[model samples]
Target chain A: GAGVSQSPSNKVTEKGKDVELRCDPISGHTALYWYRQSLGQGLEFLIYFQGNSAPDKSGLPSDRFSAERTGGSVSTLTIQRTQQEDSAVYLCASSRDMSSGANVLTFGAGSRLTVL
Target chain B: AQSVTQPDIHITVSEGASLELRCNYSYGATPYLFWYVQSPGQGLQLLLKYFSGDTLVQGIKGFEAEFKRSQSSFNLRKPSVHWSDAAEYFCAAWRSNTGKLIFGQGTTLQVKP
Candidate 1:
């Protein structure tokens, strides 16, 4: 794709329900990231994927938050037993390479999740 | 740890007025800095970045930012504000060794004609 792509631009789920958000990064990009943006709050780093290395999950808020990238092209963020506080926009970004020094990130139209 | 701070939560400017947005970062070493703009319902668009050399970096949409290493600041500026420039602006920092970016609370710009 010409740019990063995310699915289901908006989602509304009951509290405690699980939700899945998808992201498709640009072709040939080796670095991907996930972030969450809450109302009036800054973007929070969630996870990073670089090649086949173990993902950097240091920013995951809790055990309920998990993500996976398949074939190094598409990624999915899954939230189990979602809470009302989880209502936010989930953003996905990708870069050409980790060592490229051109750390310019290409972002996708985020998925707005509303946990009611 | 790397962190960014955008002091002005909201800024209002009349069309054609010059604009400036302040940003500060905390990092042990020199860090890569970036500014991004987000229009309603759209993805973040990179405005500019400061990596090395030339304190002033030019970006798209007639935006520029200067890196003040001494003050640990990288402020975004535009010579003239436009109605389309009303958007949420974010400042971010990342360690060159690690590409993870730490973003600051965004500054919302409102342009009035």
Candidate 2:
């Protein structure tokens, strides 16, 4: 793909239901990131994947929020027992590498999740 | 910990008028600053970034930003505003070691024709 692609552009689920969001990053990009955008919180980093190494999960809000990157290209973010506060736009971004140089990221349209 | 701050929650400017947006960052070391724009229902697009060298950096769409190290500020500026420039602007700082971005609360730019 020419740019980062995300699935389920919009999802509305009942409370306590689990939801999954997918992301397909640009070809050959080794760095991928997941972010959440809410009404007043702005963009918050959720997770980061760099190659096969362990993902940086420091930003995951809770135990229910988790993510995985398969084949180093496609990524999935799963939220368990969704809460009304979990409603937000989930965004995916990819970068060429993690070098000291400018790390410009390409973002996807994002998936809007609404927990009812 | 690193954080970015955008003071103005909303800014309104008349068409063809000069515009400026203020941003500040808190970091212990040199920061990699960036400005991104988001149109309605669209993804974030990078406007410009400051990694090293010249304090004044030019970006796409005739936008420019200046990095003031002493004040820890990176302000975006444009010579003239257009109707199409109406969008949400975000200021961010990248932690090179961690490869994560800290974004500010974003400023909504309203251009009046």
Per-model TM against the reference? 0.97, 0.97
Model 1 residue B6 CA deviation (Å) reads 0.4
Error of 1 at B9 (Å): 0.4
| Tens digits of lDDT, candidate 2, B76-106 | 9999999999999999998788778889999
lDDT score for residue B40 of model 2: 91
Per-residue C-alpha lDDT of model 1 across residues B1-113, encoded as one tens digit per residue: 57899999999999999999999999998888999999988889999988899999999999999999999999999999999999999999988576688899999999999
Expressed as tens digits, the lDDT of each residue in A1-116 for candidate 2 is: 89999999999999999999999999998889999999766899998889745457889999999899888899999999999999999999999988846788999999999999
Docking class of 2: high
Report clash pairs, candidate 2: none
Clashing pairs in 1: none
Second chain alone, TM-score for each candidate: 0.96, 0.97
Single out the weakest 10-residue window by summed lDDT for candidate 1 chain A: A49-58
